[model samples]
Target: MAQTATTGTTVAEVMAELAALEDPRIREVNVRHGDDHGVNLTKLRAVAKRLKTQHELARELWATGDTAARLLALLVCRPKAFERDELDTMLRDARTPKVHDWLVGYVVKKSPHAEALRVAWFADPDPVVASAGWALTTDRVARSPEGLDLPGLLDVIEAQMKDAPDRLQWAMNHCLAQIGIEHAEHRARALEIGERLEVLKDYPTPPGCTSPFAPAWITEMVSRQHTP
Candidate 1:
């Protein structure tokens, strides 16, 4: 087991801890998800718990460009403190899936710049950036759907999702499922689109895990919502 940070919280010490925690097996698993880190997330979060929030330290750790260290930095940084453009730059630099996921889920989602960035990245030439935009859109679909063009979103998914790169395809599939589960008005069309496109239809889902195939995912979630 790697030692938890009980003493030093400086970049050098935290990075040393991260390097010490690396496991070849963990890296092997993470590589499948487009990540390159090996530190267990539970231990990383434990380290963050000891260090608490140190936004400046977070920046320095992120500057190191180490995957585990950036993951740690995300845990310790204040989300709302980042400028919009700074977040954009970080997203552009975050090429790995885990780092990109954490940046979007932990920081960008909480930042006031979320919507602006969502709109900006939605049509980005980079599929990875567009995937983040779709991820943000999925959040909005579930939480606040007031002014979003549900039909237009469905149209876009119907048109582009099948041919999108892996990450963007997954994100679009999520948005499709969210629309189907949350809005009864769009449920039928969402399911219909999913069935017609056949995206992720053959994906191997682990036991008791819902398929990322959109129609099945939508049906399972919607069923759970109505479960007694």
Candidate 2:
């Protein structure tokens, strides 16, 4: 493990460290996720651990135009420092699904403006923005369902989920699962929507993994929550 940098590090220094930690096999795996820099996640984490948290450094690193560095930026960024327009810029710069997912899941979801962004992005014309919106909504539903318009959310899913873009559909399906598992009052309605949409019905599930298909996923999650 690299020694933790006691002082602020520059983007150049972080890039140098990342270069030193590059591994071909790990890069191949990253490639599958649309990261071509071939930097291993373990190596990135090791470096990020050493770098600690430096919001300014994170922005500089993200500006260096490398996929792995951008990912590390998400790990170290100060979510509060990100204003709405900056986040919008970041979303525009997120050229691939992997980066988009990380920015939304790890960074945006933690921002103070998450709720506003979620509602706005869910309705955005851009698929990526809309996907992130739904993704954030899923997180909100799972973590803090208070004050959320659950019935309205379900109505949107019921009406538009079938025609939603692929990524949006996945997030919508996840939102349905979260509702079914966490909100007993809405579980039956969620299950009904799942049956009607039949989302991910034919999607393959890995052996020993629960299917993301809403009905099965809801049933499994509910069963686990009730167990013991």
Candidate of highest TM-score: 1
- Residue 192 in candidate 2 has what lDDT? 96
Q: Candidate 1 lDDT (Cα, whole model)?
A: 0.93
lDDT value, candidate 2, whole model: 0.85
TM-score of each: 0.95, 0.89
- lDDT per model vs. reference: 0.93, 0.85
Tens digit of per-residue lDDT, candidate 1, span 70-161: 99999999999999999999999999998999999999999999999999999999999999999999999999988999999999999999
Local error of candidate 1 at residue 94 (angstroms): 0.5
Model number with the top lDDT: 1
For all the candidates, what are their Cα RMSDs to the real structure?
3.3, 3.1
